[model samples]
Target: MSALQEELILSSPYQEFEREEWKDLNGQFNLNLESTDIHSLHALNEPLNMKEIEEIYFPLAHLIELHIKNHDTIRDDSNSFFQRNQQKLPFIVGIAGSVAVGKSTTARVLTKVLSLLPHKPKVELVTTDGFLFSNKVLLEKNIMNRKGFPESYDTKKLLHFLSAIKSGIPQISVPMYSHLEYDILEDEEQKIIEPDILILEGINVLQVTSQKGQNNKVFVSDFFDFSIYVDALEKDIISWYVNRFESLRATAFQNPTSYFHKYADMSLLESREMATQIWNEINKPNLHDNILPTKYRADLILQKGSDHFVESIKVRKI
Candidate 1:
Protein backbone atom coordinates (compact mmCIF):
# COMPACT_ATOMS: atom_id res chain seq x y z
CA MET A 1 0.00 0.00 0.00
CA SER A 2 1.05 3.57 -0.57
CA ALA A 3 2.22 5.58 2.44
CA LEU A 4 -0.71 7.95 1.92
CA GLN A 5 -3.26 5.12 2.03
CA GLU A 6 -1.51 3.64 5.04
CA GLU A 7 -1.59 6.99 6.82
CA LEU A 8 -5.30 7.39 6.07
CA ILE A 9 -6.09 3.97 7.40
CA LEU A 10 -3.99 4.44 10.49
CA SER A 11 -4.80 7.92 11.71
CA SER A 12 -7.06 9.91 9.43
CA PRO A 13 -10.37 11.04 10.85
CA TYR A 14 -12.03 10.40 7.49
CA GLN A 15 -13.57 7.26 5.98
CA GLU A 16 -12.81 6.99 2.28
CA PHE A 17 -15.20 5.64 -0.41
CA GLU A 18 -14.35 4.78 -3.97
CA ARG A 19 -16.65 6.14 -6.69
CA GLU A 20 -18.71 2.97 -7.02
CA GLU A 21 -19.02 2.69 -3.26
CA TRP A 22 -20.11 6.28 -2.99
CA LYS A 23 -22.70 5.87 -5.72
CA ASP A 24 -24.31 3.01 -3.83
CA LEU A 25 -25.18 5.46 -1.05
CA ASN A 26 -27.56 7.35 -3.33
CA GLY A 27 -30.76 5.71 -2.17
CA GLN A 28 -32.66 8.67 -3.54
CA PHE A 29 -35.44 8.84 -6.13
CA ASN A 30 -37.36 11.54 -7.98
CA LEU A 31 -34.42 13.88 -8.45
CA ASN A 32 -35.96 16.92 -10.28
CA LEU A 33 -33.11 17.61 -12.67
CA GLU A 34 -33.12 17.70 -16.48
CA SER A 35 -30.24 17.62 -18.95
CA THR A 36 -30.89 21.24 -19.81
CA ASP A 37 -30.62 22.24 -16.15
CA ILE A 38 -27.47 20.17 -15.70
CA HIS A 39 -25.85 21.79 -18.73
CA SER A 40 -26.64 25.26 -17.43
CA LEU A 41 -25.00 24.48 -14.07
CA HIS A 42 -21.54 23.63 -15.36
CA ALA A 43 -18.76 26.20 -15.49
CA LEU A 44 -16.39 26.70 -18.38
CA ASN A 45 -14.53 23.51 -19.34
CA GLU A 46 -16.24 21.54 -16.57
CA PRO A 47 -18.68 18.94 -17.85
CA LEU A 48 -21.78 17.77 -16.01
CA ASN A 49 -24.10 14.98 -17.08
CA MET A 50 -26.98 12.93 -15.71
CA LYS A 51 -24.58 10.05 -15.18
CA GLU A 52 -22.41 12.26 -12.97
CA ILE A 53 -25.45 13.51 -11.07
CA GLU A 54 -26.79 10.01 -10.56
CA GLU A 55 -23.44 8.50 -9.65
CA ILE A 56 -21.97 11.32 -7.59
CA TYR A 57 -24.00 14.41 -6.69
CA PHE A 58 -27.39 12.81 -5.98
CA PRO A 59 -25.92 11.03 -2.97
CA LEU A 60 -24.13 14.18 -1.92
CA ALA A 61 -27.33 16.22 -2.09
CA HIS A 62 -29.13 13.62 0.00
CA LEU A 63 -26.30 13.73 2.53
CA ILE A 64 -26.53 17.51 2.74
CA GLU A 65 -30.30 17.28 3.26
CA LEU A 66 -29.61 14.93 6.19
CA HIS A 67 -27.18 17.43 7.63
CA ILE A 68 -29.71 20.24 7.32
CA LYS A 69 -32.30 18.18 9.16
CA ASN A 70 -29.85 17.45 11.94
CA HIS A 71 -28.95 21.11 12.10
CA ASP A 72 -32.63 22.02 12.59
CA THR A 73 -33.04 19.36 15.26
CA ILE A 74 -30.06 20.68 17.17
CA ARG A 75 -31.38 24.22 17.03
CA ASP A 76 -34.74 23.14 18.34
CA ASP A 77 -33.15 21.18 21.18
CA SER A 78 -30.92 24.13 22.05
CA ASN A 79 -33.87 26.51 22.09
CA SER A 80 -35.77 24.23 24.44
CA PHE A 81 -32.79 23.84 26.73
CA PHE A 82 -32.16 27.58 26.89
CA GLN A 83 -35.86 28.53 27.21
CA ARG A 84 -35.39 31.10 24.44
CA ASN A 85 -37.19 31.37 21.10
CA GLN A 86 -34.25 32.33 18.92
CA GLN A 87 -34.56 32.11 15.16
CA LYS A 88 -32.88 29.21 13.44
CA LEU A 89 -29.84 30.10 11.39
CA PRO A 90 -29.55 29.04 7.78
CA PHE A 91 -27.49 25.88 7.31
CA ILE A 92 -24.35 27.16 5.64
CA VAL A 93 -22.48 24.76 3.36
CA GLY A 94 -18.95 25.71 2.36
CA ILE A 95 -17.36 24.27 -0.81
CA ALA A 96 -13.65 24.80 -1.27
CA GLY A 97 -11.23 23.84 -4.02
CA SER A 98 -8.38 24.96 -6.25
CA VAL A 99 -9.15 27.02 -9.36
CA ALA A 100 -10.51 25.00 -12.31
CA VAL A 101 -11.36 22.04 -10.06
CA GLY A 102 -15.16 22.23 -10.71
CA LYS A 103 -16.22 23.81 -7.41
CA SER A 104 -18.72 26.03 -9.25
CA THR A 105 -20.40 23.07 -10.93
CA THR A 106 -20.57 21.19 -7.66
CA ALA A 107 -22.17 24.11 -5.86
CA ARG A 108 -24.72 24.81 -8.60
CA VAL A 109 -25.66 21.15 -9.00
CA LEU A 110 -26.02 20.65 -5.28
CA THR A 111 -28.07 23.82 -5.00
CA LYS A 112 -30.46 22.70 -7.73
CA VAL A 113 -30.91 19.23 -6.25
CA LEU A 114 -31.37 20.48 -2.72
CA SER A 115 -34.02 22.94 -3.80
CA LEU A 116 -36.01 20.02 -5.17
CA LEU A 117 -35.89 18.08 -1.91
CA PRO A 118 -39.11 16.54 -0.68
CA HIS A 119 -39.57 19.55 1.60
CA LYS A 120 -38.82 21.88 -1.35
CA PRO A 121 -36.49 23.83 0.84
CA LYS A 122 -35.05 27.15 -0.25
CA VAL A 123 -31.43 26.80 -1.31
CA GLU A 124 -29.15 29.70 -2.21
CA LEU A 125 -25.72 29.53 -3.83
CA VAL A 126 -23.01 32.16 -3.35
CA THR A 127 -19.46 32.28 -4.61
CA THR A 128 -16.59 34.04 -2.85
CA ASP A 129 -15.65 35.52 -6.21
CA GLY A 130 -18.21 38.19 -5.38
CA PHE A 131 -16.18 39.11 -2.32
CA LEU A 132 -12.90 39.44 -4.17
CA PHE A 133 -11.38 42.87 -4.57
CA SER A 134 -12.01 44.51 -7.91
CA ASN A 135 -9.24 45.04 -10.42
CA LYS A 136 -8.93 48.65 -9.36
CA VAL A 137 -8.69 47.73 -5.71
CA LEU A 138 -6.15 44.99 -6.41
CA LEU A 139 -4.08 47.39 -8.48
CA GLU A 140 -4.28 50.05 -5.79
CA LYS A 141 -3.22 47.48 -3.23
CA ASN A 142 -0.46 46.46 -5.69
CA ILE A 143 -1.55 42.81 -5.49
CA MET A 144 -3.30 42.32 -8.83
CA ASN A 145 -1.13 39.31 -9.51
CA ARG A 146 -2.33 37.78 -6.25
CA LYS A 147 -5.97 37.86 -7.34
CA GLY A 148 -7.16 34.55 -5.90
CA PHE A 149 -4.87 34.63 -2.88
CA PRO A 150 -6.36 34.98 0.60
CA GLU A 151 -5.18 38.58 0.88
CA SER A 152 -7.07 39.75 -2.18
CA TYR A 153 -10.52 39.35 -0.64
CA ASP A 154 -12.53 41.75 1.44
CA THR A 155 -12.42 39.43 4.42
CA LYS A 156 -14.28 41.86 6.63
CA LYS A 157 -17.15 42.16 4.17
CA LEU A 158 -17.43 38.41 3.66
CA LEU A 159 -17.48 37.79 7.38
CA HIS A 160 -20.12 40.43 7.83
CA PHE A 161 -22.27 38.82 5.14
CA LEU A 162 -21.97 35.41 6.76
CA SER A 163 -22.76 36.94 10.09
CA ALA A 164 -25.90 38.46 8.62
CA ILE A 165 -27.01 35.13 7.16
CA LYS A 166 -26.54 33.35 10.46
CA SER A 167 -28.32 36.21 12.18
CA GLY A 168 -31.34 35.51 9.96
CA ILE A 169 -31.11 38.90 8.33
CA PRO A 170 -33.35 39.12 5.30
CA GLN A 171 -32.49 40.31 1.79
CA ILE A 172 -28.75 40.52 2.25
CA SER A 173 -27.02 42.03 -0.75
CA VAL A 174 -23.75 40.54 -1.92
CA PRO A 175 -21.32 42.27 -4.28
CA MET A 176 -21.63 41.03 -7.83
CA TYR A 177 -18.66 39.72 -9.79
CA SER A 178 -18.42 39.44 -13.56
CA HIS A 179 -16.19 36.73 -14.99
CA LEU A 180 -16.26 38.37 -18.42
CA GLU A 181 -15.22 41.74 -17.02
CA TYR A 182 -12.95 39.97 -14.53
CA ASP A 183 -13.97 42.38 -11.77
CA ILE A 184 -16.62 43.29 -9.25
CA LEU A 185 -19.61 45.27 -10.51
CA GLU A 186 -19.89 48.17 -8.11
CA ASP A 187 -23.47 48.96 -9.08
CA GLU A 188 -24.83 45.42 -9.04
CA GLU A 189 -25.51 43.10 -6.11
CA GLN A 190 -26.96 39.63 -5.63
CA LYS A 191 -29.66 39.43 -3.01
CA ILE A 192 -29.74 36.39 -0.75
CA ILE A 193 -33.11 36.31 0.95
CA GLU A 194 -33.63 34.02 3.91
CA PRO A 195 -32.57 30.74 2.32
CA ASP A 196 -33.09 27.58 4.29
CA ILE A 197 -29.67 26.45 3.14
CA LEU A 198 -26.82 28.56 1.73
CA ILE A 199 -23.97 27.07 -0.26
CA LEU A 200 -20.82 29.21 -0.16
CA GLU A 201 -18.35 28.07 -2.81
CA GLY A 202 -14.82 29.34 -3.35
CA ILE A 203 -11.14 28.50 -3.15
CA ASN A 204 -10.94 30.67 -0.05
CA VAL A 205 -13.90 29.20 1.78
CA LEU A 206 -11.90 26.73 3.93
CA GLN A 207 -8.88 28.99 4.36
CA VAL A 208 -7.65 30.30 7.70
CA THR A 209 -7.50 34.05 7.22
CA SER A 210 -7.40 36.81 9.79
CA GLN A 211 -7.33 40.58 9.64
CA LYS A 212 -4.23 42.34 10.92
CA GLY A 213 -5.86 43.46 14.16
CA GLN A 214 -8.64 40.94 14.51
CA ASN A 215 -9.50 40.26 18.10
CA ASN A 216 -12.21 37.73 17.29
CA LYS A 217 -10.61 34.42 16.39
CA VAL A 218 -13.54 33.29 14.28
CA PHE A 219 -12.67 31.79 10.89
CA VAL A 220 -14.90 31.53 7.80
CA SER A 221 -15.58 27.83 8.32
CA ASP A 222 -17.13 28.59 11.71
CA PHE A 223 -20.25 29.72 9.86
CA PHE A 224 -20.45 26.48 7.89
CA ASP A 225 -22.63 23.65 9.18
CA PHE A 226 -21.01 21.39 6.56
CA SER A 227 -17.88 21.86 4.46
CA ILE A 228 -16.51 20.26 1.28
CA TYR A 229 -13.07 20.37 -0.27
CA VAL A 230 -12.73 19.33 -3.94
CA ASP A 231 -9.28 17.85 -4.27
CA ALA A 232 -7.09 16.43 -7.08
CA LEU A 233 -3.47 15.82 -7.97
CA GLU A 234 -1.69 19.15 -8.39
CA LYS A 235 -0.56 18.16 -11.86
CA ASP A 236 -4.13 17.45 -12.93
CA ILE A 237 -5.34 20.74 -11.50
CA ILE A 238 -2.62 22.67 -13.34
CA SER A 239 -3.61 21.03 -16.57
CA TRP A 240 -7.28 21.87 -15.95
CA TYR A 241 -6.40 25.46 -15.16
CA VAL A 242 -4.41 25.79 -18.39
CA ASN A 243 -7.19 24.17 -20.35
CA ARG A 244 -9.80 26.49 -18.82
CA PHE A 245 -7.67 29.51 -19.61
CA GLU A 246 -7.37 28.35 -23.21
CA SER A 247 -11.13 27.83 -23.39
CA LEU A 248 -11.81 31.29 -22.05
CA ARG A 249 -9.43 32.78 -24.63
CA ALA A 250 -11.62 31.32 -27.34
CA THR A 251 -14.91 32.42 -25.77
CA ALA A 252 -15.06 35.04 -23.03
CA PHE A 253 -11.69 36.60 -23.77
CA GLN A 254 -12.77 37.50 -27.30
CA ASN A 255 -15.04 40.15 -25.82
CA PRO A 256 -13.39 43.54 -26.16
CA THR A 257 -14.15 44.43 -22.56
CA SER A 258 -12.73 41.22 -21.14
CA TYR A 259 -9.80 41.72 -18.83
CA PHE A 260 -7.95 39.04 -20.74
CA HIS A 261 -8.95 40.27 -24.19
CA LYS A 262 -5.28 40.81 -25.01
CA TYR A 263 -4.79 37.06 -24.99
CA ALA A 264 -7.73 36.38 -27.33
CA ASP A 265 -5.74 37.24 -30.44
CA MET A 266 -2.69 35.26 -29.36
CA SER A 267 -1.75 32.05 -31.16
CA LEU A 268 -2.56 28.73 -29.53
CA LEU A 269 1.05 28.30 -28.41
CA GLU A 270 1.20 31.81 -27.00
CA SER A 271 -2.06 31.37 -25.08
CA ARG A 272 -0.88 28.07 -23.63
CA GLU A 273 2.42 29.64 -22.55
CA MET A 274 0.59 32.56 -20.92
CA ALA A 275 -1.77 30.22 -19.08
CA THR A 276 1.13 28.12 -17.83
CA GLN A 277 2.99 31.20 -16.66
CA ILE A 278 -0.04 32.47 -14.73
CA TRP A 279 -0.61 29.08 -13.16
CA ASN A 280 3.06 28.67 -12.18
CA GLU A 281 3.44 32.20 -10.85
CA ILE A 282 0.08 32.80 -9.17
CA ASN A 283 -2.53 30.04 -8.91
CA LYS A 284 0.00 27.25 -8.18
CA PRO A 285 1.62 29.00 -5.21
CA ASN A 286 -1.78 29.98 -3.78
CA LEU A 287 -2.97 26.38 -3.98
CA HIS A 288 0.08 25.00 -2.17
CA ASP A 289 0.32 27.77 0.39
CA ASN A 290 -3.31 28.51 1.24
CA ILE A 291 -5.81 26.08 -0.32
CA LEU A 292 -4.28 22.58 -0.20
CA PRO A 293 -3.35 22.89 3.49
CA THR A 294 -7.04 23.16 4.39
CA LYS A 295 -8.06 19.91 2.67
CA TYR A 296 -8.14 17.81 5.82
CA ARG A 297 -9.98 20.54 7.67
CA ALA A 298 -13.07 19.92 5.52
CA ASP A 299 -15.93 17.71 6.67
CA LEU A 300 -15.84 16.04 3.24
CA ILE A 301 -13.33 15.87 0.43
CA LEU A 302 -14.14 15.00 -3.20
CA GLN A 303 -11.07 13.61 -4.88
CA LYS A 304 -11.21 14.14 -8.62
CA GLY A 305 -9.60 12.19 -11.44
CA SER A 306 -7.64 13.53 -14.41
CA ASP A 307 -10.88 13.44 -16.38
CA HIS A 308 -12.39 15.96 -13.90
CA PHE A 309 -14.84 13.49 -12.37
CA VAL A 310 -14.87 12.55 -8.72
CA GLU A 311 -12.93 9.33 -8.14
CA SER A 312 -13.42 9.03 -4.40
CA ILE A 313 -14.96 10.71 -1.42
CA LYS A 314 -13.60 11.07 2.09
CA VAL A 315 -16.07 11.94 4.81
CA ARG A 316 -14.87 13.11 8.19
CA LYS A 317 -16.01 10.62 10.81
CA ILE A 318 -18.52 12.08 13.21
Candidate 2:
Protein backbone atom coordinates (compact mmCIF):
# COMPACT_ATOMS: atom_id res chain seq x y z
CA MET A 1 0.00 0.00 0.00
CA SER A 2 1.09 3.58 -0.65
CA ALA A 3 2.27 5.64 2.35
CA LEU A 4 -0.70 8.05 2.03
CA GLN A 5 -3.22 5.16 1.91
CA GLU A 6 -1.67 3.54 4.97
CA GLU A 7 -1.72 6.84 6.89
CA LEU A 8 -5.42 7.43 6.12
CA ILE A 9 -6.27 3.89 7.18
CA LEU A 10 -4.47 4.45 10.51
CA SER A 11 -6.40 7.57 11.45
CA SER A 12 -7.54 7.77 15.05
CA PRO A 13 -10.50 5.60 16.05
CA TYR A 14 -11.64 8.26 18.59
CA GLN A 15 -13.58 11.20 17.15
CA GLU A 16 -14.13 13.62 20.00
CA PHE A 17 -16.55 16.55 19.91
CA GLU A 18 -17.49 19.43 22.17
CA ARG A 19 -20.90 19.34 23.84
CA GLU A 20 -22.43 21.65 21.26
CA GLU A 21 -20.96 19.66 18.40
CA TRP A 22 -22.57 16.47 19.67
CA LYS A 23 -25.88 18.17 20.51
CA ASP A 24 -26.17 19.38 16.91
CA LEU A 25 -25.89 15.85 15.53
CA ASN A 26 -29.61 15.10 15.88
CA GLY A 27 -30.71 18.74 16.11
CA GLN A 28 -32.61 18.54 19.40
CA PHE A 29 -34.83 15.62 20.42
CA ASN A 30 -38.11 16.43 22.10
CA LEU A 31 -37.36 16.85 25.84
CA ASN A 32 -39.63 14.18 27.27
CA LEU A 33 -38.36 14.33 30.89
CA GLU A 34 -39.95 16.82 33.28
CA SER A 35 -38.98 18.40 36.62
CA THR A 36 -40.62 15.50 38.45
CA ASP A 37 -38.80 12.99 36.26
CA ILE A 38 -35.47 14.71 36.83
CA HIS A 39 -36.10 14.84 40.57
CA SER A 40 -36.84 11.12 40.58
CA LEU A 41 -33.79 10.17 38.54
CA HIS A 42 -31.16 12.62 39.75
CA ALA A 43 -28.71 11.37 42.35
CA LEU A 44 -28.00 13.09 45.65
CA ASN A 45 -25.80 16.17 45.01
CA GLU A 46 -25.44 15.10 41.36
CA PRO A 47 -26.15 18.65 40.05
CA LEU A 48 -27.89 17.53 36.84
CA ASN A 49 -30.11 20.07 35.06
CA MET A 50 -32.42 19.72 32.06
CA LYS A 51 -30.15 21.91 29.93
CA GLU A 52 -27.39 19.31 30.21
CA ILE A 53 -29.85 16.53 29.39
CA GLU A 54 -31.15 18.25 26.28
CA GLU A 55 -27.66 19.02 25.01
CA ILE A 56 -25.92 15.80 26.01
CA TYR A 57 -28.08 12.82 27.01
CA PHE A 58 -30.88 13.08 24.45
CA PRO A 59 -28.35 12.92 21.63
CA LEU A 60 -26.73 9.91 23.27
CA ALA A 61 -30.09 8.14 23.53
CA HIS A 62 -30.70 8.84 19.85
CA LEU A 63 -27.32 7.40 18.92
CA ILE A 64 -28.10 4.29 20.93
CA GLU A 65 -31.41 3.95 19.10
CA LEU A 66 -29.51 3.92 15.81
CA HIS A 67 -27.13 1.33 17.19
CA ILE A 68 -30.03 -0.87 18.29
CA LYS A 69 -31.63 -0.70 14.85
CA ASN A 70 -28.34 -1.47 13.11
CA HIS A 71 -27.68 -4.39 15.43
CA ASP A 72 -31.14 -5.86 14.73
CA THR A 73 -30.71 -5.53 10.96
CA ILE A 74 -27.29 -7.20 11.03
CA ARG A 75 -28.66 -10.07 13.10
CA ASP A 76 -31.61 -10.52 10.75
CA ASP A 77 -29.37 -10.49 7.67
CA SER A 78 -26.91 -12.98 9.15
CA ASN A 79 -29.68 -15.30 10.28
CA SER A 80 -31.33 -15.17 6.84
CA PHE A 81 -28.06 -16.12 5.14
CA PHE A 82 -27.89 -19.27 7.27
CA GLN A 83 -31.73 -19.78 7.13
CA ARG A 84 -31.69 -20.24 10.90
CA ASN A 85 -34.58 -19.54 13.23
CA GLN A 86 -33.34 -17.87 16.42
CA GLN A 87 -34.60 -15.39 18.97
CA LYS A 88 -33.37 -11.80 18.62
CA LEU A 89 -30.93 -11.09 21.41
CA PRO A 90 -31.12 -8.20 23.83
CA PHE A 91 -29.07 -5.09 23.02
CA ILE A 92 -26.74 -4.73 26.01
CA VAL A 93 -25.34 -1.29 26.91
CA GLY A 94 -22.80 -0.91 29.67
CA ILE A 95 -22.39 2.33 31.63
CA ALA A 96 -19.25 2.57 33.73
CA GLY A 97 -17.83 5.34 35.90
CA SER A 98 -16.28 6.03 39.27
CA VAL A 99 -18.44 6.04 42.40
CA ALA A 100 -20.33 9.36 42.87
CA VAL A 101 -19.55 10.42 39.30
CA GLY A 102 -23.24 10.27 38.34
CA LYS A 103 -23.11 7.08 36.24
CA SER A 104 -26.20 5.81 38.04
CA THR A 105 -28.12 8.99 37.32
CA THR A 106 -26.99 8.82 33.69
CA ALA A 107 -28.23 5.27 33.41
CA ARG A 108 -31.57 6.13 35.04
CA VAL A 109 -32.08 9.10 32.70
CA LEU A 110 -31.24 7.07 29.62
CA THR A 111 -33.58 4.27 30.69
CA LYS A 112 -36.45 6.74 31.00
CA VAL A 113 -35.65 8.62 27.79
CA LEU A 114 -35.13 5.49 25.71
CA SER A 115 -38.41 4.09 26.96
CA LEU A 116 -40.04 7.26 25.61
CA LEU A 117 -38.64 6.69 22.12
CA PRO A 118 -40.93 6.37 19.10
CA HIS A 119 -40.25 2.63 18.99
CA LYS A 120 -40.81 2.41 22.77
CA PRO A 121 -38.66 -0.70 23.10
CA LYS A 122 -38.74 -2.34 26.51
CA VAL A 123 -35.76 -1.14 28.58
CA GLU A 124 -34.46 -2.22 31.97
CA LEU A 125 -31.59 -0.99 34.17
CA VAL A 126 -29.35 -3.14 36.33
CA THR A 127 -26.30 -2.35 38.41
CA THR A 128 -23.26 -4.54 39.04
CA ASP A 129 -23.80 -3.76 42.72
CA GLY A 130 -26.63 -6.29 42.59
CA PHE A 131 -24.07 -8.97 41.80
CA LEU A 132 -21.78 -8.07 44.67
CA PHE A 133 -21.15 -10.68 47.31
CA SER A 134 -23.19 -10.26 50.48
CA ASN A 135 -21.66 -8.56 53.49
CA LYS A 136 -21.70 -11.86 55.34
CA VAL A 137 -19.63 -13.43 52.59
CA LEU A 138 -17.25 -10.46 52.61
CA LEU A 139 -16.88 -10.67 56.38
CA GLU A 140 -16.18 -14.37 56.16
CA LYS A 141 -13.60 -13.77 53.43
CA ASN A 142 -12.04 -10.91 55.47
CA ILE A 143 -12.40 -8.43 52.62
CA MET A 144 -15.06 -6.23 54.22
CA ASN A 145 -12.97 -3.05 53.91
CA ARG A 146 -12.37 -3.75 50.23
CA LYS A 147 -16.07 -3.67 49.46
CA GLY A 148 -15.97 -1.75 46.16
CA PHE A 149 -12.92 -3.57 44.86
CA PRO A 150 -13.40 -5.78 41.82
CA GLU A 151 -12.53 -8.86 43.87
CA SER A 152 -15.39 -8.08 46.25
CA TYR A 153 -17.98 -9.17 43.66
CA ASP A 154 -19.07 -12.56 42.42
CA THR A 155 -17.72 -12.28 38.89
CA LYS A 156 -18.75 -15.82 38.09
CA LYS A 157 -22.41 -15.16 38.92
CA LEU A 158 -22.37 -11.84 37.05
CA LEU A 159 -20.95 -13.58 33.99
CA HIS A 160 -23.57 -16.31 34.12
CA PHE A 161 -26.39 -13.76 34.46
CA LEU A 162 -25.34 -11.78 31.38
CA SER A 163 -24.70 -14.96 29.46
CA ALA A 164 -28.27 -16.04 30.18
CA ILE A 165 -29.64 -12.71 28.93
CA LYS A 166 -27.59 -12.74 25.73
CA SER A 167 -28.56 -16.36 25.08
CA GLY A 168 -32.18 -15.11 24.82
CA ILE A 169 -33.37 -16.53 28.09
CA PRO A 170 -36.93 -15.32 28.63
CA GLN A 171 -36.56 -14.76 32.37
CA ILE A 172 -33.54 -14.22 34.61
CA SER A 173 -33.26 -13.11 38.25
CA VAL A 174 -30.38 -11.07 39.71
CA PRO A 175 -29.61 -10.54 43.37
CA MET A 176 -30.73 -7.28 44.99
CA TYR A 177 -28.58 -4.86 47.04
CA SER A 178 -29.64 -2.16 49.53
CA HIS A 179 -27.57 1.02 49.84
CA LEU A 180 -29.35 2.09 53.02
CA GLU A 181 -28.59 -1.22 54.68
CA TYR A 182 -25.33 -1.40 52.72
CA ASP A 183 -25.56 -5.10 52.07
CA ILE A 184 -26.89 -7.63 49.59
CA LEU A 185 -30.53 -8.49 50.33
CA GLU A 186 -30.95 -12.14 51.33
CA ASP A 187 -33.53 -14.23 49.47
CA GLU A 188 -34.66 -11.39 47.23
CA GLU A 189 -33.91 -10.78 43.54
CA GLN A 190 -34.76 -8.52 40.63
CA LYS A 191 -36.51 -10.33 37.77
CA ILE A 192 -35.31 -9.37 34.32
CA ILE A 193 -37.75 -10.43 31.61
CA GLU A 194 -36.36 -10.23 28.06
CA PRO A 195 -36.13 -6.50 27.54
CA ASP A 196 -35.17 -5.11 24.14
CA ILE A 197 -32.55 -2.90 25.83
CA LEU A 198 -30.57 -3.57 29.01
CA ILE A 199 -28.66 -0.78 30.70
CA LEU A 200 -26.00 -2.39 32.89
CA GLU A 201 -24.47 0.38 35.03
CA GLY A 202 -21.74 0.21 37.63
CA ILE A 203 -18.21 1.22 38.59
CA ASN A 204 -16.59 -2.00 37.33
CA VAL A 205 -18.75 -2.63 34.29
CA LEU A 206 -15.96 -1.74 31.82
CA GLN A 207 -13.31 -3.84 33.57
CA VAL A 208 -11.86 -6.56 31.29
CA THR A 209 -10.89 -9.23 33.79
CA SER A 210 -8.78 -12.00 32.37
CA GLN A 211 -10.15 -15.50 32.75
CA LYS A 212 -7.93 -17.41 35.13
CA GLY A 213 -6.43 -20.67 33.77
CA GLN A 214 -8.31 -20.39 30.50
CA ASN A 215 -7.69 -19.47 26.88
CA ASN A 216 -9.93 -17.48 24.48
CA LYS A 217 -12.28 -16.34 27.25
CA VAL A 218 -14.47 -13.21 27.11
CA PHE A 219 -14.83 -10.13 29.32
CA VAL A 220 -18.03 -8.28 30.27
CA SER A 221 -17.69 -5.77 27.41
CA ASP A 222 -17.83 -8.63 24.92
CA PHE A 223 -21.56 -8.88 25.58
CA PHE A 224 -22.18 -5.14 25.30
CA ASP A 225 -23.36 -3.85 21.91
CA PHE A 226 -22.49 -0.35 23.20
CA SER A 227 -20.87 1.04 26.33
CA ILE A 228 -20.34 4.43 28.01
CA TYR A 229 -17.78 5.76 30.47
CA VAL A 230 -18.42 8.93 32.46
CA ASP A 231 -15.24 11.02 32.80
CA ALA A 232 -14.10 13.73 35.24
CA LEU A 233 -10.91 14.83 36.93
CA GLU A 234 -9.94 12.95 40.08
CA LYS A 235 -9.91 16.12 42.14
CA ASP A 236 -13.42 17.06 41.07
CA ILE A 237 -14.70 13.56 41.81
CA ILE A 238 -13.24 13.68 45.32
CA SER A 239 -14.99 16.93 46.03
CA TRP A 240 -18.27 15.54 44.71
CA TYR A 241 -17.91 12.49 46.94
CA VAL A 242 -17.57 14.68 50.01
CA ASN A 243 -20.61 16.70 49.03
CA ARG A 244 -22.68 13.56 48.49
CA PHE A 245 -21.66 12.23 51.88
CA GLU A 246 -22.82 15.44 53.55
CA SER A 247 -26.14 15.30 51.72
CA LEU A 248 -26.73 11.63 52.52
CA ARG A 249 -26.00 12.27 56.19
CA ALA A 250 -29.19 14.33 56.47
CA THR A 251 -31.12 11.80 54.35
CA ALA A 252 -30.29 8.06 54.04
CA PHE A 253 -27.96 8.05 57.02
CA GLN A 254 -30.61 9.54 59.27
CA ASN A 255 -32.63 6.34 59.08
CA PRO A 256 -32.18 4.28 62.25
CA THR A 257 -31.64 1.08 60.25
CA SER A 258 -29.02 2.56 57.96
CA TYR A 259 -25.61 0.97 58.12
CA PHE A 260 -24.09 4.44 58.15
CA HIS A 261 -26.49 5.84 60.76
CA LYS A 262 -23.57 6.47 63.09
CA TYR A 263 -22.41 9.14 60.69
CA ALA A 264 -25.75 10.95 60.86
CA ASP A 265 -24.92 12.70 64.10
CA MET A 266 -21.46 13.90 63.16
CA SER A 267 -20.85 17.62 62.85
CA LEU A 268 -20.51 19.06 59.33
CA LEU A 269 -16.79 19.52 59.85
CA GLU A 270 -16.36 15.97 61.16
CA SER A 271 -18.50 14.51 58.37
CA ARG A 272 -16.54 16.17 55.61
CA GLU A 273 -13.28 15.04 57.16
CA MET A 274 -14.49 11.44 57.37
CA ALA A 275 -15.74 11.52 53.79
CA THR A 276 -12.39 12.78 52.51
CA GLN A 277 -10.57 10.09 54.45
CA ILE A 278 -12.76 7.32 53.06
CA TRP A 279 -12.36 8.59 49.54
CA ASN A 280 -8.61 8.57 49.79
CA GLU A 281 -8.52 5.20 51.51
CA ILE A 282 -11.09 3.32 49.44
CA ASN A 283 -12.96 4.94 46.56
CA LYS A 284 -10.02 6.95 45.21
CA PRO A 285 -7.75 3.94 45.06
CA ASN A 286 -10.42 1.83 43.36
CA LEU A 287 -11.08 4.49 40.75
CA HIS A 288 -7.47 5.02 39.77
CA ASP A 289 -6.33 1.40 39.94
CA ASN A 290 -9.38 -0.34 38.46
CA ILE A 291 -12.19 1.83 37.09
CA LEU A 292 -10.39 4.69 35.28
CA PRO A 293 -8.15 2.24 33.44
CA THR A 294 -11.21 0.91 31.56
CA LYS A 295 -12.41 4.32 30.32
CA TYR A 296 -11.17 4.05 26.74
CA ARG A 297 -12.76 0.63 26.33
CA ALA A 298 -16.18 2.28 26.18
CA ASP A 299 -17.88 2.86 22.80
CA LEU A 300 -18.60 6.43 23.92
CA ILE A 301 -17.46 8.66 26.78
CA LEU A 302 -19.23 11.52 28.50
CA GLN A 303 -16.62 13.89 29.91
CA LYS A 304 -18.13 15.90 32.76
CA GLY A 305 -16.97 19.26 34.04
CA SER A 306 -16.36 20.08 37.70
CA ASP A 307 -19.95 21.25 38.04
CA HIS A 308 -21.24 17.79 36.89
CA PHE A 309 -22.57 18.77 33.47
CA VAL A 310 -21.45 16.75 30.46
CA GLU A 311 -19.10 19.18 28.70
CA SER A 312 -17.82 16.89 25.95
CA ILE A 313 -18.33 13.52 24.31
CA LYS A 314 -15.79 11.15 22.81
CA VAL A 315 -17.24 8.79 20.20
CA ARG A 316 -15.42 5.72 19.00
CA LYS A 317 -15.48 5.46 15.21
CA ILE A 318 -17.07 2.39 13.62
lDDT of 2 by residue, 1-318 (tens): 999977765685778899879888864457557798888988888877788777887888899989998998999998999899778988999999999899999999999988888878899999999888899999998989999898888888888999999999999999999999999998789999989999999899888866344443767788899999999998899999999999999889999999999999999999999999999899988998899999989999999999999888889998
Task: Report, for every candidate in turn, its global Cα lDDT versus the true structure.
Answer: 0.89, 0.89
Candidate 2 residue runs with Cα over 4 Å from true position: 1-11, 211-216
- Residue-level lDDT of model 1, residues 129-211, one tens digit each, is 99999899999989998999988998889999999998889889999999888899999999998899999999988877564
Candidate with top TM-score is: 1
After superposition, the stretches of candidate 1 with alpha carbons farther than 4 Å from their true spots are: 1-8, 211-216
TM-score of each: 0.95, 0.93
lDDT of 2: 0.89
